[model samples]
Target: MSQSDAARWEARYQAGTAAYAAQPSAFVLDWLPRLPRGRALDVACGLGATAIALAEAGFDVTAVDIAPTALARARTEAERRGVTVDWQCADLSDLRLPPAQYDLIVNIHYVNRDLTAQFAEALRPGGHVLFEQHLRWPTPVDGPGSDHFRLRPGELRHLLWQLDILHYAEGPFDGRDGERLALARAVGLKHH
Candidate 1:
């Protein structure tokens, strides 16, 4: 992530009274009942919502983000919720995830296409990855308009093709902010 991009996210998190909801992503919640309690990683864990949920579910959770401001808020929330999460501040664009370290990985509303391979490598064998992100829509909504930040149609499936897909969905959906968005959601299991 660029310094400017990080600054932008910091500003957003700092300005809003509640930049993001305290609840976990819908996709995460949907799969939570089926996931094993184990070491989990939440990438770009803005506000640490999903991370907090994972911790509460008895998973040892680590949440990473580029913005220090966001991570700070996440830490405060985790403390308030009475759950421990390892909050890490790092730019995923350059950070190398540890190999075979996580049993479950949750990535929501963040797009780092370059990290797909690393995400697979970071998961232990038979581990699962739950990912959801905004897609390039016909008309711009409240998302980064660039193709670089948005996934193309069917792009995510192709990206994680090596893994066994447990579930996949793509289409317009209502966002937390009540805005309409084209999104892609998926769950992939690493081969054992």
Candidate 2:
């Protein structure tokens, strides 16, 4: 994405017309048992749903997003939900992150293939990475947005093959016009 695209997302958040929900994603709730009781990072955390959820689930969470408006909304929701999360406004593409610090790293509904290796490096020994995103589907009509942001078939699982894969799947799922969801979840342990 170009500079203009990032600015557009900021402008959209600033508009405040899009209703940001205060609840967490269902996938996160479903796999709550898999998360470790330690520090976690929520990447591209729009509105802080996943971040807040992690905190409530007893993990120290750092929520990072590019849009200040979105971060503001997330902060408000975290307070309303009576949980604490460290909110950071920074572009992950350029931000320097600590490696091997977190016990869990989460990415939901966001796609940045270039960061796959970086994410793996950021995990501590026995850390798990949970990822979910929309993917390109074989449909007659084209969906919204650029093809660059959408995942191809089996791309997510393939990207993390070097890690210990716990679960993986790609297919159309319910909610929001039957989105094509791809999940590549795994645990990676550092050498002791």
Candidate 3:
């Protein structure tokens, strides 16, 4: 991530309660029952909602993010929720994910196409990945202003092609704030 981008996110998180909603992504919650309870990674884990949910679900969870302010808020949320989560403040762009170390990886509302291969390699055999991100659309919507962060149509399917796709969908949906958004969601399982 660029220094400017990091600054932008830090400002966004610090400006208001927009980033730390104390609620897990709806996509993660939907697939919670199907996911295995084991070592898990929550990439770009803003406010640790998904990490807390995973920890509550009995997974050993590690949450990573670039913003210290975000991680600090996440830590408070984790403490309040009475769940233990290993929190790391590091730029995902500079970090190397451990290979075959996680049973599941959850990434929501963040986009870094370069991390797709790392995500696959970081998961244990038969491990799962649950990902959701805003998609580029003809109409404007509330999300990252840059096209660089938005996925093109069918792009996510191609990104995770190496994994066994359990579920995949791309279309308009209600966002966290109830606004219509073009989003892509998928669940993939690495082959054992």
Model 2, position 99, has a per-residue lDDT of 84
User: Candidate 2, TM-score vs. the true structure?
Assistant: 0.86
lDDT of 2 by residue, 103-159 (tens): 888887677776766776778877877887667776632233666767777788776
Q: What lDDT is reached at residue 137 by model 1?
A: 82
**Model 3: ten consecutive residues of lowest lDDT:** 14-23
- lDDT string, candidate 3, 1-192, tens digits: 989878987887898656435679888999999877899999999888889999999999999998888899999988997999999988888788889999999988888877877888899998999999889998888777888889999999998988899999998898777888889999999999
The TM-score, computed over Cα atoms with residue i paired to residue i, of candidate 3 is 0.95
Q: Give me the candidate number with maximum TM-score.
A: 3
Least well predicted 10-residue stretch by lDDT in candidate 2: 183-192
lDDT per residue for candidate 1 within 115-158, as digits (tens), equals 87788899999899999988888876766667777899999899
Ordered by TM-score, highest first, the candidates read 3, 1, 2
- Which residue pairs in candidate 2 have backbone atoms (N, alpha carbon, C) closer than 3 angstroms, thus clashing? none
Judge candidate 1 at residue 9 and give its lDDT.
81
Between candidates 1 and 2, the one scoring higher on TM-score is 1
Q: Point out the higher-scoring one by lDDT: 1 or 2.
A: 1
My TM-score estimates for the predictions, one after another, are 0.93, 0.86, 0.95
